[model samples]
Target: MEKPSDNSGFVDSLEKLLQLCEELGQQIDEIGACLYPPQEISSIEAALEKIRNIIDVLRGMQWFLRLMRLGGLQGASDAFLEACNGLRSSLRELASEISSSNTADIEARVENITLTDK
Candidate 1:
């Protein structure tokens, strides 16, 4: 079987990351309706921290991909494959973190979206 190209992997990773981010944003909006009531502020802060970390990782991966392309890695399929693997790992990590949040409502909404897209 032909191995996947790095560019394709990177693209897939980016798209998945974007979907996670959009869902997280929607979750934040939904949860914000509940008056934090001055006590659960810490939880809100912690959730924001996780969101920030995911955003930073996604941005860093994009930057690294651009650098690799500019460094002439584009012509080398092996190099591209390596880059793609790295991006895939990062994306998967972010997805795991998002899942760990246990935002069932958001998860359901995302699932519904996936179904509708089909």
Candidate 2:
């Protein structure tokens, strides 16, 4: 697997990280909420363990996205795959950093979104 080019790809900001958790919920059914506050993580390490689960879910979604691409959108799918690949690597790095308590590797990269309410 290709490694992330840099360490700046991790989703920073706890709020944004929660949102990504919700996105993961799309494929796994409320898993983000289920594994977090509502479920009560026992410790920081437990939280990191949950994150590893999210990474697995995201990787699965990438395959699902690849399988769903239509022929008419071949180019679009290719580009999307690039982003998906990047996310997987990013998540992997995040898991590693959290597991080892190495905040040094942390980088919060929000999705390309602008919140008007903010």
lDDT string, candidate 2, 1-118, tens digits: 4545552333232344466667554633432333333332234345445555666655455443454364265676576557556655654664464455433222222222233421
Encode model 1's per-residue lDDT on 27-113: one tens digit a residue: 456335422323233454555555556555655565646755777776653454454456446446534645565455444544443
RMSD of 1: 13.3
In terms of TM-score, the best-performing candidate is: 1
User: Which TM-score value belongs to model 2?
Assistant: 0.35
Give the range where candidate 2 is weakest over 10 consecutive residues by summed lDDT.
104-113
TM-score each candidate. 0.38, 0.35
* Model 2 ranges off by over 4 Å: 1-22, 25-71, 102-118
User: Which 10 consecutive residues of model 1 have the lowest summed lDDT?
Assistant: 109-118
